[model samples]
Target: MNKVLFFAHLRDAVGEESLEVEAGGKTVAELKAELAGKYDLPRLETVMTAINEEFAANDEVIQDGDVIAFIPPVSGG
Candidate 1:
């Protein structure tokens, strides 16, 4: 299983800070697709992604037990 972490509005939208997903062998894009489908989050693709605390590309492959974080762009005045 892969741990998916949510930040900022992404967490509020999903109603959780983190979730476990079956992502072994799946690419980051695939994981995002699954999450968007499950959570009905249309903007999920716009968030920045990180795997195991390092920035990841959409095509990055996911491994079991990897920690993936989805951080939405933040802006404040």
Candidate 2:
């Protein structure tokens, strides 16, 4: 299982700071699509993804025990 973390509005969307998923062998984009559909999340294409605290590309493959975090775009004046 992989630990998926949500930030900002993404966290609110998931209603939790983090959740575990059976994501090993899946790409970041694949997981994002699954979560978006499952949770009805929005604008996931614009969200940044991080694996094990380091920024990752959509094609990056997830591994068992990896920690994934999805962070939405932040705007401020």
TM-scores of the candidates in the order shown:
0.90, 0.93
Candidate 1 lands at a TM-score of 0.90
| RMSD (Cα, Å) of model 2 | 1.5
* lDDT of residue 5 for candidate 1: 95
Give one digit per residue, the lDDT tens place, for model 1 in 55-77.
99999999889999987775768
Any runs in candidate 2 off by more than 4 Å, and if so which? Answer: 75-77
Candidate 1 Cα misplacement greater than 4 A, ranges = none
Write one digit per residue (lDDT tens) for candidate 2, span 1-77.
Answer: 99999988999888999998999999999999999999999899899999999999999999999999997886868
Residue 1, model 2: Cα distance from true site in angstroms: 0.8
Minimum summed lDDT over a 10-residue window in model 2 is located at 68-77
The global C-alpha lDDT for each of the candidates, from Candidate 1 onward, is: 0.88, 0.94
**Candidate 2 colliding pairs:** none
Cα-lDDT of candidate 1: 0.88
